[model samples]
Target: MEENFKMVAKTLFGFEEILAKELLQLGAQKIEKGVRSVSFYGDKGFMYKANLGLRTAIKILKPIHAFSVHNENDLYNAIYKMPWENYLSPKGTLAIDATVHSPLFKHSLFIAQKTKDAIVDKFRNTTGQRPNVDLKFPDIKINIHIDRHQCTVSLDASGESLHKRGYKTATNIAPINEVLAAGMILLSGWDGQCDFMDPMCGSGTILIEAAMIACNIPPNLMRKEFAFERWQDWDVDLFEKIEASLLNKTRDFHYKITGYDKAPSAIAKARENIKYARLEDFVHVQHEDFFKTRKGGHQKLHMVFNPPYGERLNIDMQDFYKNIGDTLKQNYPGTDAWFITSNLDALKHVGLRPSRKIQLYNAKLEARLVKYVMYEGSKKQKYMK
Candidate 1:
């Protein structure tokens, strides 16, 4: 039996609680929440499960060593003393990613370079050969973090961001991150109970994530690889068992999941991506302007989307947002409309007050996930007072 070890799942801002909840539901022990991160204790099999199942996590890191450092030499010496040979071979390739939150260490790039140097030098001095650095494809990906004077070294268990999901082959002008899309859907409290829609579905990310959530599907089942596949103790049979276990948990979804886009190109991309995900039976994409459309059925509906924030496009921010509000208020009733945008000024133009506003980050831009509830009754009494 494999003993449990601590692992950290790194997530975006405003998603720590959800990630922690996900870990807890996945049977992680000693769960702890941090800023944009959640830590927990899980065995090797569980680690494989996390990388394969966690939707909100950008990466999963397993901390291997920790020490305090005041200077560069201390950092180098501390990292050089580790048993790198056990984790990588002399001919293997390596990559280092660093994050610094300490006054002692300033540049993350320099920190990454220094850490890589220490490992390479250690191997060269001991075995007369060293691993080569391969940023694109590496056998071992290391993570270095500096908080104040404490340095913790970790192994990257997820090679690429879990958002890749191995399903999206096409995207529109501004496609939302898959992790952010899933996080927003999870936060909205929609659990396949009602009909789901993404009116401004750029590439259909929200729709796909909603279907996956609705079916209780593991998000990373289509992913090509994880970093642990290259680890020294990589267990193929164990990983297969974990994957099979997750697949068995997927339940059938009965509600409709649909997407709409004003552009035909966006619709094509969304359909392509949706077909690639093998969710064609559960999701439908149409090329139609949202402003001209009305709710089709009287059943309770849930809408989550990433509308343009007037960032890269040249659309009128005020009128665009006003139309969003007008369409929802007049056309769609009995719907919980939720959307994310970084344009604070434009959000005010929506006219309808948001029932809930959550501070989040869309890439580097500060954003808000706002919800507007449109009731089923008369238009005058639709909005919450």
Candidate 2:
């Protein structure tokens, strides 16, 4: 039997608690949350499941070694002394990524270089040959992290991040990141219960993400490969078993998921992306301005989207946002609308006060993921008040 091991799932800021909840729901054990990451214990099969099933995770890392470090030299010496033979051969290619949170080690790029040098130099000194570094298609990807003089090394189990879900072939001028899209959907508390929507759907990312969430589908089933597949201990049978088990857990979604984009190009791109995700039947895309339209029926609705932040797309920022508020208040009654935007200035224009606002990051820009509740009628308006 394969032994249980500790693994870390890296995520974006403000998603640690949600990611930890996801890990626990996925049957992970001894889960611990950290800044932009969550650590837990599970077997190799569990690792495969976490990689395949997690929605908010950016990457899953399996820590192979850890030690205390005083400086760069100590970091290099420790990496050099490890038995690298079991993980990668001298003939294989590798890539190193480093993150620094230590006073001693300030530069991440420098740490990556030192760690890579330690491994290759150790091999070259003994065998007159060294493994090559291939950033694009490396056989092994190593991650180095220094936290206040404590250094930890791990194998990057997720290749190219899980957000590259292999579905988006087209993008708009400012499309949201896939992981962020999934995270928003997960945070919205939607469970395929009723119909879903993204009124200003730019590329249909939220719609596709919603469909997958509804079906309990594995987010990375379409990914080309995981980094662990290149590891020496890559167990094909166990991986297949894990894949099959996750596939079996897929559920049927009875509700509809839909998207609307005002721009023709965005609608075309959304259609293309929905097709690529193989969710065309489960998701519908239409070209319609959100403010001009109202809810199709009196049914309850769930929405998640990223509207223009006025960063690159030059629409009337305040007016556009005000229209969003008006549309929801007038047209989209009995709906829970959620959108993430970096436009703090524009959010002020959205007349109605947000019911809930959560701080998050959309890349380097600090942003807010907010929710609003639109009532059904004047009778309900009193209740909302």
Best by lDDT: 1
lDDT of 1 by residue, 31-67 (tens): 9999999999999999999999998999999999999
Question: Per-residue lDDT tens digits of candidate 2, residues 175-228?
Answer: 788889888888889999999999888888889889999999899999999998
Stretches of model 2 off by over 4 angstroms after superposition: 379-385
Return the lDDT, model 2, position 290.
88
Q: What lDDT would each prediction earn against the true structure?
A: 0.94, 0.91
In model 2, state the lDDT of residue 117: 94
TM-score of each: 0.97, 0.97
TM-score of 2: 0.97
Whole-model lDDT, candidate 2? 0.91
